[model samples]
Target: MTTKPDRFARWLPIAASLLLLAGCQAAKYRTLESFGIEKRDILGSRVEAARDAQDDAREQFSSALEQFRATVEFDGGDLEDLYDRLDREYTRSVDDAERVRDRIDSIRDVAEDLFDEWEDELDAYENANLRDRSAELLRDTRSRYGRMIVAMQRAEATMDPVLEAFEDQVLFLKHNLNARAIAALRSELDGIEDDTEALVEAMNASIAEADAFIQSLEGSS
Candidate 1:
């Protein structure tokens, strides 16, 4: 005769499944850090990600500028190849800028959650002096974050006009593949050069701010 399964045996699979689900959720929603880390640590991680994104953007813009220079300065060396290079740079730049924008969004999301949690915890403090100090720190940190984000966003904003100019040049090169095209590009070289330079300057300022923000976080810890 077949015997019925015990209750413990029947529940074992369910319990294991629940545990697995919990692990997956923990890994997915990693806003809360491990090792009992607090919101500050999460903020630090976001800062690092933001810094990395900006660095990536800086490198991409630099590379795109180089390719753009190549396109304009093409001394009749493989016209098609020059167009190909410019097209590639334009596409890569769009992708890289998207990543930068996504990273900034992530930083903003985490900052909102972290600040909310911190503000809520302010009410849990029993000591008035300590509570006041925590409140002040919260404000200070928020202000710093605001400044850093503004710098990042300013840098990000500069990319669009540069990209627009690149797109126009690329389209022009795509159609006019001759000496006249080269001459046309030469005429536009100064304008493109100025835009790229301005973009680089904006990126440099943002990069410096990112470094300062990261250093502040490190110093805090």
Candidate 2:
């Protein structure tokens, strides 16, 4: 006898292939709907994932900043080894930033599909009163979504500056691995810290917006 988990495991790849063959965002959504999953559910899940990604990114950036500070303060040690460690931190930060971006893109795609479908279905209503109520609800939901996406984008924008700063410092150290380079980094440390602080603040605001949006979505369901 096949266990339920085993059955689900076997069915997962087939469902994924079907979604792939569906060929477009809207078509994929229809395929998912056939499996009893609604757009709102997918939107909520993606929002949660994006929020988690932002959280991970925040921690990773903070860790990278600390490593940078430590490297700049080095008095005597293997500078090459220090460069390698900082380079590793830079690489991890890049990966985390990419994950956040991918999650944001996924959220945007599902959100557009959900709103478009909702708007199109309004004309199918038989009762004017019901249609009016739904229309108002749709407007309100869109307004809240607008706020959430703006916050997410603002946070996303801040990430690039921080990453560039990290990359520049890492590259400079790779070439000029000496006490002079450490002194130069120390001078630039203030600017890096400022940028990172701004990033962390933006991500926190975005994460809060995500939480509020998810709660609103669930409450209405």
Question: Per-residue lDDT tens digits of candidate 1, residues 62-122?
Answer: 8887887777677767888878888998998899889889888877876887888789999
Residue 64's lDDT in candidate 2: 93
Residues forming the 10-long window of minimal summed lDDT in candidate 1: 1-10
Clashing pairs in 2: none
Give candidate 2's error at residue 170 in angstroms.
0.7
Best by TM-score: 2
lDDT of 1 at 202: 84
Off by over 4 Å in 1: 1-31, 34-37
lDDT string for model 2 (111-160, tens) is 99889989999999999999999999899899999999999999999999
Model 2 has an lDDT value of 0.90
